[model samples]
Target chain A: MKTLLDLLMLSCKKASELIDKQLLLNLSLKERLMLKIHTRLCEACFEYEKQSKLLDKLLLKHISTSEESQIPIQINIELKQKIIHNINPKK
Target chain B: MLNEMDTNNPATTITSWVKLYSDNLFSWALHKTSDREIAEDLVQDTFLVAVNSFDKFEGKSNPKSWLFAILNNKINDHYRSNFRHQTTNNTISLDEYFDANEHWRPEETPQPWLVESSHILDNPEFTKQFEECMQRLPQHWFSAIHLKYIEERKGVAICQEIGITPTNFWQILHRAKLQLRKCLETHWFKI
Candidate 1:
């Protein structure tokens, strides 16, 4: 007794959630169809999916780039001394 | 270095390992978590556990890998405990984004963000802004996003390790991304 509207209609809120879900897992056939329908009818959700994907892409790139550059971190000499002291005790 | 070192002396052996590995572990922990204090604490805890299990860990795995595995477990526990300890204060209402009918509110609706610069993330200032926005996220949400994007971990793997349901994971990501999107728009794009 499921109608096409019932199967395919999703509010932007739900559609956005499905968009995020699709990133981590494949949406069900109904979920996919509903997402497709909703994004078609909703420009905001369409922009949202695009922006969300872009954000992930940028964040990933930033992470790798920052790591490669090493963020100019100074080795924590104090923490090192502390660890050595803690582990060597009563040995 | 290890061949000449005294394996019988736990103190000397662990001290050498600490001197070698602590810096690498700290940088990694810092990357995974942007907090310096937490990163240092995790490294401290990782070594403490390593000392307790040093005999058990003997001759089984490479020291580097063994230490990393322990650190990873600590990181997972960090995420799990943060998620478990979360109260209503940690959650932001979904009503801010959607209307009573569950459609996007006019003000909260997503807008196109022009990402024309392929080298966008290369900009030092933008990267700073990005990190700041990520810092605004709840601890659990930040961990989820970090696992998914920075570590490129699988959803199922993250859910299994972090002990959160897939449905809840997606919902958190949805909300997290919305905040990120809005933050970047206001700070980077609009600027």
Candidate 2:
């Protein structure tokens, strides 16, 4: 039988993983039980779960949408030429 | 012009890969090193290595993965070669820095102070703070986090690329997150 502390740590890890997943999802049975037991006894992990969810929202907001631009035309041409020449030495 | 290439030529395939992946690879390297010059050199080195070993690439994996594997080895080599000279300048005393008793506990009824995502682009300080927090992480942990999170690679794929077990990968990520949160709390959120 896992100790309460062990169960709490597992719950914390699962809670963090869930933050990146779909919102308002139900926890796994084990996770739900761990949460019920731990949150009833330990206020810190409860607050942590809340804060982790909030942080996930903030992270999604800050994710960069900028698509990577192309390599400069000159370098692309030069590299292409080099590779072509390497493939066919007499090119 | 690359348009003149015969469709079956290996050169064409190589050039296509370069065209497709160079910018992404360069950006990845730049973010990792935080030095544009070094990043460019690393990118060039990656291509050179790929080209020289082109025959070894049996198309078993995607071109991007192959190139990244080469680049990872190059980066590791660069670090190993420079570690001695780099470590001489600023030595941290571990005993003075780490305290087992200084454990962190989350606040009770934590006030939500989430920054809006729209502000990240405009706020240079936030980006700087993020980069600083990233830099404080151990190199392996930092690499694991960047490859997994920023690159958006799945755990199994990242494990394949980095040659680490899934358990080790999770451990690295856990440590990295814990350190980043601690750094952020101390550097940005302390009131």
In the range B35-127, model 2's lDDT, one tens digit per residue, is 566677787778877766777876767788888778767765554444323323233222222234321223312233454544543466776
Please provide, for model 2 over A22-57, each residue's C-alpha lDDT reduced to its tens digit, 9 standing for 90 to 100.
232345777666556655554544655565544433
lDDT of each residue in B90-164, candidate 1, tens digit only: 454689889999988888888777787568776778878988999999787877676666466677777777667
Which structure among the candidates has the greatest TM-score? 1
Q: C-alpha displacement of B153 in model 2, angstroms?
A: 4.6
The candidate scoring highest on lDDT is: 1
Clashing pairs in 1: none
TM-score of 1: 0.80
* Residue range A25-56, candidate 1, lDDT tens digits: 88889888888888888889899888888887
